[model samples]
Target: MDKNQLGVQYMQEGNWEEAAKAFNDAIEENPKDPVAYINFGNVLSAVDDDEKAVKFYQKAIEIDEHAGAAYYSIGNVFFTQDRFTEAKKMFETAMKKGLESSDNFFMLGLTLVQLNQGKLALPYLQRSVELNEHDAEARFQYGLCLAQLELIDEAILQLEKCIELDPDHSDAFYNLGVSFAFKETSVKAIEMFNKALEIQPDHLLAGHAKKLIENNL
Candidate 1:
């Protein structure tokens, strides 16, 4: 069998080390094979060597400037390292190069939120929600962005949708409680806190919300 075929066989069998070695050999045999670099990078990423993986991904992009997967992979490595600015730049580059996955947009939105640029994150988050409205985390984060913009009612609706989609999401319940608290609806806030506690018995925010409710009551 060819080196590429053998490398793929090893990769499918979960022999990542062997897969990396085989793919590396394939690259050595054909220096211009972008797929070999990309496959090797994937193995490195799976093995948690993100720094090396980024270099291999970069090599793939150098071979093909429009390699959206390469750009996305590099962005993921930067994000894992908490280099939000670099990650954002790389994600933008990937998008500009026609990366159209919902996950890509979702990651971009999440990074923007982490940087406290929720307004800038809105369009990406909105696109993600439009693609999959039942994504609980996406809905919850969209609500958070809305709340940050002082769109209280819309935020509450989004949080409510999150809870509806995943009834066991303690964070969604907790955030909904916070939204109610912001509106001075102590009763509703208490209810949401109770729901959160039901889902996550050890949730710190739920316990704190309970205390606040009692104090206000």
Candidate 2:
């Protein structure tokens, strides 16, 4: 395999040192290749070297102004740092640079959610789910954005699909309980809360909601 592909395989195996070596070789082989710089940045990012990662990503961008993956990687760094506004900008730029991946849409949507712009986040999150139907986390986030908008039924649908894709998702179960409670379906709400508790015994929200509902009933 080529050095870049070898680097990616090493990354997938969680061998950061070898991945870095492979990427370094790739960069040495072709200094103008933006993909190598991006891959190197990803290694640094995985290792929690955010500052160095950003520098590598910047180098990729310098080599290729239209490098969408570089922008996307930088956005991820900002997102992990909770710099949501900056993350939003980078993801938007990535989109404008022709990166229409599901992950780009998801990150942008998630950034908007972090910024308390649920209404704005909804469409991007929806598009992410449309692009990758099997992504449980995307479904869960879309459900959360819907819930925040007071679209409880739609939220419940998404949350249900999330749990179907990932049955052990306690958060989805807990949120499902909340959605059912909003519909005044106490029994179903309690059942969902119990399911959440079964999955995660220390789910405080689910426990509290169950008690609150029982007391009211």
Off by over 4 Å in 1: 1-36
TM-score of each: 0.84, 0.99
Q: Report clashes for each candidate as comma-separated counts.
A: 0, 0
Using TM-score as the measure, the top candidate is: 2
Query: Where does model 2 exceed 4 Å of error?
Result: none
lDDT (CA) for every model shown?
0.88, 0.98
In the predicted model 1, the residue pairs found to clash are: none
How close to the true structure is residue 34 of candidate 2, measured as C-alpha lDDT?
A: 98
What is the per-residue lDDT of model 1 for residues 1-217, given as tens digits with 9 covering 90 to 100?
Answer: 8777888899899999889889999999998887788889989988899989989998998898988878888888888889999999988888998988777788899889888898999999989899888799889888989888888899999999998898898988988888899898998999999999999999998899789788868
Candidate 2 residue lDDT tens string, 25-89: 99999999999999999999999999999999999999999999999999999999999999999
The residue-level lDDT of candidate 1 at 35 comes to 77
Model 1 global lDDT (CA atoms, 0 to 1): 0.88
